[model samples]
Target: MIITLTLNPSVDISTTIDHLVPEQKLRCAAARYDPGGGGINVSRAIHRLGGKSRAVFPVGGATGSLLEQLVAEQQIDFQTVPMAGWTRQSFVVTETSTRQQFRFGLPGPAWSMDERELFLNTVLTFPKPIDYVVISGSFPPGLPADYCAVIARIVRQRGARLILDTSGEPLRMAVQEGAFLLKPNLGELASLVGVDKLELDEVEEAARSVIQRGWCEVVVLSLGPAGALLVAKTGHADQRIERFRVPAPTVKKQSTVGAGDSMVGGMIYALSQGKSYEEMLRFGVACGTAATMNPGTELFHKDDVERLLNWINQSGKKVFLPVADGIN
Candidate 1:
């Protein structure tokens, strides 16, 4: 079984306006609401791709109730931990004229120590043995940075792979303790290696450095439109690493919201299906590219993913990058 944890989930509301002038009364269209948060979006995307994952998150107040209703409406299996504070809401407004999107986010209500313990216990103590524990999104205010590291330790004890997709200090802490896989963008990957920024040619070395240090077994560096770079070990005791780069298939762009989560969701689904690392990257890029063809947080359709995957597989020869020497 696959389980996802979202520490700071939100109700994502998206709408459009004709224009944005000098802050005059801008009448917006009817709003569209979806369960917003890294793990929630990943679970929704997995469901859309004909896969299943149990989503675990906390809830509070009326907004939290609404979020539960939304998740239920999507037919996702979920378990919620109760909290005293209200959940946060995020807004995405698009200017119809220029097609520019503006996203406004709120820092979620601070979580108390007791509340944090309850939430963590709920996640780790699920009745079924979890095959993959995906802890995505950001930590709520007041949670310690070491929280992710603690989870990593416990997950290791249970012998389940943890696919961590997050950023900043919490992400760094998790890396120190190690995870099965990490999907960080170029910027986040640079931060992991203590760099301000990285050049395109420098991506492979930076990713390899993380693996060499025993932080993560696999690193999938997301490159936005250019596609993704994957680095992983061929065996446990082996110093050698395998690398692959899959280019994104061109598509008519609409909205970029949820594309990263869609990529993670697709990759996790592919992994659960016993696909090769190369096939996982290909299918994942297909899902992410397909997500760009929709507005708001609608994610991608299975048909679009299939068509794009076929196009990607037909060009598989270009996907494999030449193997490089082991960590020295």
Candidate 2:
């Protein structure tokens, strides 16, 4: 089973105004509220893709209750750990005239030391075997970077693969502990490799470097509209890696809020179904691109994903794999 852990989940509120003029009481259309955060959104996207995943997060206060109700409405199974402070809320406003979007986020409440132990224990003691454990989103206040390393150890002990999507020191710690898969954008990739910048051609080598260091078995580099590149080990002692690239299909763009999470959902779901690496990347890109077709924190629809996946399969974009430059 797939289990997603969102350390700092939020209730997302989105609305659109005809014009976003400053110093004016501009009216907005009716607002839409949804459960938000990296892992939570991944669970939602997995559900939309006709898959199941259990979302695990801490909830507190009235806003937390609202978040639970919203997640329930999506028909996703979840488990929550109680927190002393309230869950955070995120706001998204779109200017209809200019097609511009503005997002506001609040920091999550701090977690006490006791609370941290309980949360870690809760994850470590899941009743059933977990096929994949996805730890996404930001670290809540007072949650140290090493907590990610602790999580990595838990996944290892449980014999489950870990899929990580985060930034900064937490990301570094988690990578140091090793993971099955990592979804990092270009900027995050550059950071992981200790570089200031990375050109398009430099991406493959940078990703493979992470694999060579035994940090992760697979690195899916998210390149936004340019699509994604996958660098993974072939599982032989030779330390050879295979690479594949897929371009994002053009669509009427909306909001890019949950596209990365959607991509994670799609890829993990495909992996659970025993799909090939190329198929997984295609589905992931399709789900991510399809998510851009909707506004606000919404994920992709099943129909849209299927259509986009078919398009990707027929687009004739070649999957590039060079001769094995065996890891030293």
Candidate 3:
């Protein structure tokens, strides 16, 4: 079984407006709400692709109930850890004319130490023989920065492969404990290595550096529109840094939100099915492109993902790679 943990889940409200006028009343052309947070998005994507996974998150207040209903509608298995405060909510405003989006996010509610303990205990009790565990998204207020690292350690100890996607200090700490995979965009990768930013030439070097430090066995650096780079662990003579560039497909612009999560979902789905790393990367790129073809925070549909996958297979480009120096 696959288990995904979202420490801070949210209710995503996306609205489309015709135009924006300073401090003036505006009418919305469309509005939609969805249960969100990185893990929830991953679970939804997996379900759409006909895979099974469970989503575990903390919930509270009216918003939490609404989120539960949304998940139930999708028929995805979910386990909610009750909290004393309301779950966070994010608002996405899109302009129809300009196709521009502005998002307002709220800091999630605080979690007491007891609540944190409960979360940890629940995770430890997950049925044994778990195949993979994904720890993604931000930490709620009052939750320690080491929260993700602790979860990753437990997951690893239980014999399940771990995939961690996050940013900043939590991500740094989690990587130190070592995970099976880490997916960070180019910018996030730069931050992880204490660099201000990285040019295209510097990406592979940075990715290889992370792997050498024992942070993860595989590091996938996502370069939006330019595709992604897969850095393999050192020492294996056959190991080499592979690069894939999925040219952004032409699409009516909407919102870029959730594209990264969709990519993670696609990659995990392929991995769970025992696909090769190259195939998984292609599927991930396809899923991300599909998500961008849609509006707002909505994820890619099964049919769209399939279409993109077919296109990717037909392209048949040899993803480039960088030469590896023995360092394992």
Candidate 4:
């Protein structure tokens, strides 16, 4: 089974405005609310694709109750650890004129030491072995920076694959534990490597270096419209690290919110089905493209994913870059 752990979850409210004028009171044309966080988004995307996965999260107060109801309405399996504080809410505003999105996220509720211990113990008591344990999103306040690293250790000790998709200090600590997969966008990767920014060549070197240092078995650096690069740690000269550049599809991009999370979901869904890395990346890219066709954090449906996959396969223009020997 696939399991996703979201340390900080929220009720995401998304609204659409014809144009975003900074100093004015603009009326929203449309709006929607959903349970959101990186890992929850992953679970929702997987469910949309007819995949089964459980979302494990911390909840508190009325907001948390609402989030639980929302998840249930979507038919997602969720397990929660109750907290003393109220859950947070986030706002995502999409400008229709330019297809630009702005997200305002709140600092989540603080967690007591006892609450943290309970969460860790609950995670340790999974009823069955999970195929993949996805640790994603920001850590709530009062949580340790090494929280993800500790979870990674637990997941590793249970012989399960760990996929981390996060940023900041938690990401820094988790990398030291060496997860099975680390999916960081270019900016996040740059932060992990302690650089202000990276040029294209620098990005490649940083990704490869992460793999070489044993911080992660595989490093996937997402390049937005340019697609993603996958670096494997096998170190075989003939084993070329694959780069899949998904040219942004020609569509009315209503929103880019949750596109990355959808991609991760698609990739994890494909991997859970025993698909090859190449196939997984292709499917993931398709899911991301399909997600852009909508207006919010809403993910791609199964039919949408299939349609996008068909378009990608028909295009037949994927580029493959061979890894030079002895580079590591």
Model 2 C-alpha lDDT per residue in residues 144-231, reported as the tens digit of each score: 9899999999898899999999998899888998899999999999999999999999999999899888899999999899899998
- Candidate 1 vs candidate 4: the lDDT winner is 1
TM-score of each: 0.97, 0.97, 0.94, 0.92
Clashes of each: 0, 0, 0, 0
Go through the candidates in order and give each one's C-alpha lDDT.
Answer: 0.90, 0.92, 0.84, 0.83
What are the per-residue Cα lDDT tens digits for candidate 1 across 22-110? 85988999999999899999999899988999999999999999999999999999999999999999999989899998889998889
What RMSD, rounded to one decimal, does every model reach?
A: 1.3, 1.3, 2.0, 2.3
- What range of 10 consecutive residues in model 3 has the weakest lDDT sum? 319-328
Worst 10 residues of 1 by lDDT: 319-328
User: Which parts of model 4 are misplaced by more than 4 Å?
Assistant: 18-30, 97-99, 234-244, 317-327
Comparing 2 and 3 on TM-score, the stronger one: 2
lDDT of 1: 0.90
> TM-score of predicted model 3?
0.94
Q: Which pairs, if any, clash in model 2?
A: none
Q: Which tens-of-lDDT digit does each residue in 74-110 have in candidate 4? A: 9999999999999899999987777778899999999
